[model samples]
Target: MSEKLGAERLMPNEWRDDLEALDLEIVRFAIICQVKLLEPGVIQRVLDNDARDCIHGNQTAFASLRGLLFLHFQMQKDLAEAYGPSDATEIVRRVWAHLQPRVGDQLGSLPNPGALSAV
Candidate 1:
């Protein structure tokens, strides 16, 4: 028999849009880090804000973005542990490039995370 569909399965197309927005946020963060140095605390705040907004009204998309972000950080940490600091930045750059296409134009005009540091 076919699996029964639940109410939760009926997500609106907006949620996909939200996920794409979240992806753009991640890409912005990566770009800022590339151009200028950002403090760790600053980076954390940006990620926290993105996660919070994503979580507030859209749980499913938020959860997915959170998971992806977590995995991204974990993989970066693992690579750092294995290859040393010199290689960590390059790995992160490549990862960000891979993610950019997936997010496409959904990012809108969100501020770069690094810019937040000055505020």
Candidate 2:
């Protein structure tokens, strides 16, 4: 979170606060998305692209980095453009919850939602 904005260092506390707020918003949207019970197509495309990268020799670690970038930046951008920011936020939340449990269970550990968001 110490990334620079222009010349000033991004304050750690403020960055964390922003991240936490984002996490809460995402959680709320996720709950709403779950009620709808269908994965947004945009999310699917992001996952698909990640899978393609893995198949083309991207290491798991790098693939994860790419996935994060796509989800937080690209996916949000695309969803917001197509559906507006508020709706896009909901989709992000839904996609987060939808993906997390499935991936975690497959790896034999169901992550507590929000457990690692602060880190």
| Leading candidate by lDDT | 1
Q: Report the number of clashing residue pairs per model.
A: 0, 2
Clashes of 2: 2
Badly placed stretches (over 4 Å) of model 1 are: 1-52, 98-105, 108-119
Q: How far off is residue 43 in model 2, in Å?
A: 17
For each candidate, the alpha-carbon lDDT, in order, equals: 0.43, 0.40
Task: State the RMSD for candidate 1.
Answer: 13.2
lDDT of 1: 0.43
lDDT of 1 by residue, 42-102 (tens): 3354346443333134445444444555554654454446555445545444444555466
Measured with C-alpha atoms, the lDDT of residue 94 in candidate 1 is 45
Model 2 misplaced stretches (Cα beyond 4 Å) = 1-64, 105-119
**What's model 2's lDDT at 27?**
36
